[model samples]
Target: MLDAHLTTQLKAYLEKVTQPIEIVASLDGSAKSAELNELLEEIAALSERISLVRRDDNERRPSFAINRVGSDVGVRFAGIPMGHEFTSLVLALLQVGGHPSKTAADVIEQVKNIEGDYHFETYFSLSCQNCPDVVQALNLMSVLNPNIQHVAIDGALYQDEVDARQVMSVPTVYLNGEVFGQGRMSLEQVLAKLDTGAGAREAEKLKNKEAFDMLVVGGGPAGSAAAIYAARKGIRTGVAAERFGGQVLDTMAIENFISIGYTEGPKLATALEQHVKDYDVDVMNLQRAERLLPAAESGGLIEVQLANGATLKSKTVILSTGARWRQMGVPGEDQYRNKGVAYCPHCDGPLFKGKRVAVIGGGNSGVEAAIDLAGITSHVTLIEFDSKLRADEVLQRKLHSLPNVDIIVSAQSTEVLGDGQKVNGLVYEDRVNGEVRRVELEGIFVQIGLLPNTEWLKGTLELSPRGEIVIDERGRTSLPGVFAAGDATTVPYKQIVIAMGAGSTAALSAFDHLMRLPVAAKPELVAA
Candidate 1:
């Protein structure tokens, strides 16, 4: 009768409860028996207060993992999470609210010290799989904490962004808004900076301000030439480019460029870059211009907008955007590029010294490359899609006079043969035989004409059917105050000397346009 009455009263009390119940106690655990007795008393009280605690008896329940054995608290120590310690700690933390596993502890320690935002901008090309590690590290740091942000930029997709940042190498990470560290760095090194709070302080110190004057759009021969001239004229200049040396960087050797007749393309590019460094020019590497717009009325400034949202305002703008090698668009053409297949004989021909190499296409460029390669390599095979070489008679004569040079008429490259990584050789089909034959070679040069890089300017500027920018002799484009030079423009012959001359002409014309602008518009004309 007494128990039934008590149960009834308890049910009535439970029905009246509306708020969360709380229990607070500080038990002395120093004495073993006393601590156990206290814990038991607390547990008994908890069971009476909670129906769920009272319902469970022998089977493992919610508090089993946390329950102390005797009067001691169950604790574990970890030195290193080398083997299974890391996994064990992580699983324990996930399973119950105890000590974190060794691995989890280490991971926490690794990223816990990061107190401020870290912004990393890295460049990577499709060809570089090694950059994935860098991307993963930065991403891991970002995910582990809130104060870190990592951005992995594709070199090709964000060409303009890369150009604006002047990225020359892959895995170039910029912290906050300024360049932090470069190349492949270890996780420990990165952690050390975060742990010491140096990176956070450094990030806080960076200031956003305009630091450049005139930013030349390209870094081809013409662009470099223009930058050199502009810097020498006492103008603060910046050169933004996807690649510092431009397309010429891929060339192996140049025997035709005046003054320096015999030099590797990469070497020449390096020299040019060094020369620019000698001046006050701010060379921004690996940037691409996404848009060009007139700046707001700030004295006399013209702005070049990059894909990265960075803008360069200059008093004078010189566009020396160059052209790229025209691909055959054949089955294996792209697959073989820079492998057994090549675009510039001057760049890759030396690699085939004492070996066979094929020069594709029948135009003057093809004939010229074949003639040049024949002198350096042991054997040269000239494969032309057309029935005859379309070069000038003198070039044709020069090509035919070479004893080791074999001219294969009416032959077209059908397939480039090799693994996905590198080209081994190529398969060509003869118009007469309708049969295909493979030619083994150390390398192949695609000497077809280049395609102008003017697709972005399609509606904005006048372009020929071939897509070259149409400009006057003075390098002025159809649009007012716009000028173009180098291979992108409607220049007849594409050569270093010619591009340099055209760049000089364009720079002078741009200067003239800037001078004509009103004094109030000068700032707008010159902000970079």
Candidate 2:
């Protein structure tokens, strides 16, 4: 079950169904199958137009086929639709119940005109917040065209298939038995891959010597802001990123972005990309910067070599490469990463609602996560490696005020304890007593410090001891014509608002540097 509020919302949403929709579930009386059947029955009870039909088919025991009353659009889900993916089931029902899709006209037309039979097998985890987007997109495409079929496979339930495919991550899409992608992908990106024979063109190189006046080397909130600010100056601006939404994509709920009372990471990321597209910023996705080199000619250009064997020359480069969460390097951590071990509390916390969970690390982030989870989960256990928590006094006071939170100091996490399916407990050492203990919990949230993505700039730019790029107040790096911002720099705090402000400052500094250059040395302004 859904809560009262969520049930009311789903009821209202399901009331719009004008045509009958049937959910045919194949079950074999297994535990997961029983859970899935109950979920389907509960959902089907919401509307008079919806019905659930259970078949005792051992071959596809845990699979469900969604079919419209009059049509034979093949859409199947082979897992329990819980957690964030519950939205996918609802959307699929609405799509099958005679509601027109909200996809773009061009995209719908393209989907309708596909020639060959394309089978998309999208492997996903229930806890993954980003998997629903890809699943919904593929399901919609399948509904639009009979030639295109999509099967949503739960990576946890079907371990044999997942291991056979070597799927180490959630949302691993396979097209015609080959790996298409590994993470969140947009509908347009998937369409592009379908158009071209290549699965997903994530690392394609530039065709010619692309140039820009201001080039941003990331695509998080910082890089998006920098590109928008630079484009406002009516100069040639370009942004290269491994993905359009850096760490933001991995995040879940984002309530700290000022003025925006509530929003999710993927929603904010989509808005950021749309805002950047509104300007003249040349965005190159799936391009990773490998090496940074100054041009042979003095005061000429900076060359950014990409992993795809393409080089980009720019007058100024703003480094906004974000940081990644530090891992505990414990056993079973990698094996059950998306299953029960998660780095993002905002993203995966809801999956453990009303269940016991533990937060690793007692700093600001760990305390914040514990506070946030206390209201949702049944219990919160905060474990710290240090003698005392390093969080601010205000945060500590607030954390202590919660009744459901328990703190353990000087506890060194040794290993993650999990069954072959998912995490069940955690093992840690009591530093003060020199004893090892296991804490029984269903989920573990790691809120350790971040590791800057500045390994490529080690010898090129001056970095701090923690490998963060050193930058002045004006965002200027030690190397001339190079600037750094956001988590990749020596910034004190790594917040979204702070990163956006830093990005704006870096863009202004680059503009000021360009304005001071001689007429011959200045970059040419291309028409927007």
Candidate 3:
């Protein structure tokens, strides 16, 4: 609801105005187009009135401006702009009605010359105060040029995707597919990126880079390390990832990883990604390699055919494709994932400190989580569908000794209970007695089994019986110039330090492979 004062002001303003007004009741239903239509109608009317009022006020110029450079300004809206930002919205609308400000005019001039379609996604929650200004700015830009496609995603409406993206704040702007800039950006800053035309084109060109010193597949720990090392060594390193950070970003916390004692998955991934950025490393975040063919023209260049119809050529390939956690396959599992339910205990356990929580599955991860949660929380219920805990006796003894921990044997989780916003508790049924009961708790942790993310590399690389990548002693794979490491590979002990060490090893080996090749290339490297 709007404040009474502003409502009164708006009502007064509306009563005096004869402009065609259409209120957007919700942030849905062709909002961009509708708002745009309304804005155009208002601007056109203002244009007509400007000539009549301009004779007396010579200093006051008319509103509205257009760019001749690219096509559009491309404003991406994220949330509903009401409340305090409403004023900002009105100002923006007024600016849109009048001539474009110097900054907006310059941006329009720059965007008019752009060749490709610029897709911008703005993420916002309803509670955000400054989001309306961003939405208005993007809408204005979209109206300025038809080439700009602005997408406003209401975080309140899509909480699941918000959580999945690990969006901690509102008004995050994504240019193209990568993060362009965060928070409220000045119109000039937005124009600078548009004028450069480098960031967006780099990813597209990477798809066609025929020859690289190092080709790092996947965007997990090992592959990132390998790519960073190779790039730092001045080797042309290209990383083809289905998604940047792979499975590592899905984790909530990584306590066991050495040096970085307690860090969120996305934070760690971001740190590594930042490191990769420090050098010239070509990272394809959302690109998937479809096939690996040995170079036909010699020089050890491996042609990596991508599913996106782009080919990546490299001298050495490092495969660090990691594994994923097995889901319970229960209904609402996907919807509730990362909301109230989670797969990685180490990442998200601290969120439930001093609260009662439940752990599903009695494997090593489950036992470890139960024991770990015991240190912070008061009560932890371990529900196992199997007859017994599959962890070692030492862990089992530790879990049994904890007074707050309860082990429910042969119990299966039927459904995750929550308010469709966040996890509040869970429901389980005893396999033996067939009795179902609801448990009230703060959160539920799922740690069933690990599933390798190697489906894409099935025919290309040799996989173990468990679906993990098969690697030699030095992280070398069955194929020449290809190596594997981390949890995705044959290395045992799926610990953070182990993965890190394995990644380091694969990186060094990949560097060695690249060094063994002919002419030296000092590739620029960046961490991803």
Q: Which one wins on TM-score?
A: 2
**1-528, model 3: which lDDT tens digit per residue?**
344675566544434332222222222335553453344344334333211111212111111222222333323223444433355445443433343443435456665656677777776544344344455556555656667666666654455665666543456677787877654444544664676654345447775566877778887777777777777778677777776666666554577777666875655775787788778987666666777776554445777777656678777777777777788888767776656576555434544556788899888778988998898777999999989889988899899999999999889898877777677778889899899988898677888878877777788768899889898889988787887778888898886667767877888887887666678688989898
lDDT of each: 0.61, 0.85, 0.65
Q: Worst lDDT window (10 residues) for model 2?
A: 196-205
What is candidate 1's lDDT per residue for 1-528, written digit by digit as tens? 114554454344434332222212222323432433343343234223321112223121111122122321221211111121222222321222222232336546667566776666655443332344455456555545656665555444444565566553455677877877654444545675556653343223221325444557888888888788778778677787766767666554478888876875656776887888788887765457777665444434666766555667676667777998898778887655545676655434444557788888878788888988888789988898888889889999998889999899898788887765556677889988899899987677888878887766777668999999888989888766667889998899998779989988887777677667666544446668
> How many clashes in each structure?
38, 0, 33
Task: Note each model's CA RMSD in angstroms.
Answer: 23.6, 6.4, 14.0
Ranking by TM-score: 2, 3, 1
Best by lDDT: 2
How many angstroms is residue 193 displaced in model 3 relative to the true structure, after the best TM-score fit? Answer: 19
Q: Which regions of candidate 3 are displaced past 4 Å?
A: 1-204, 295-300, 330-358, 363-381, 390-406, 412-445, 515-528
Q: List residue ranges in candidate 2 displaced over 4 A.
A: 1-74, 77-128, 140-148, 151-205, 296-299, 330-332, 349-357, 371-380, 390-406, 416-427, 433-443, 521-528
Q: Estimate each model's TM-score.
A: 0.53, 0.73, 0.53
Model 3 accuracy (lDDT, Cα): 0.65
User: Tens-digit lDDT track for model 2 on 276-313?
Assistant: 99998888876789999864443488889887677788
* lDDT, model 2, position 106: 69
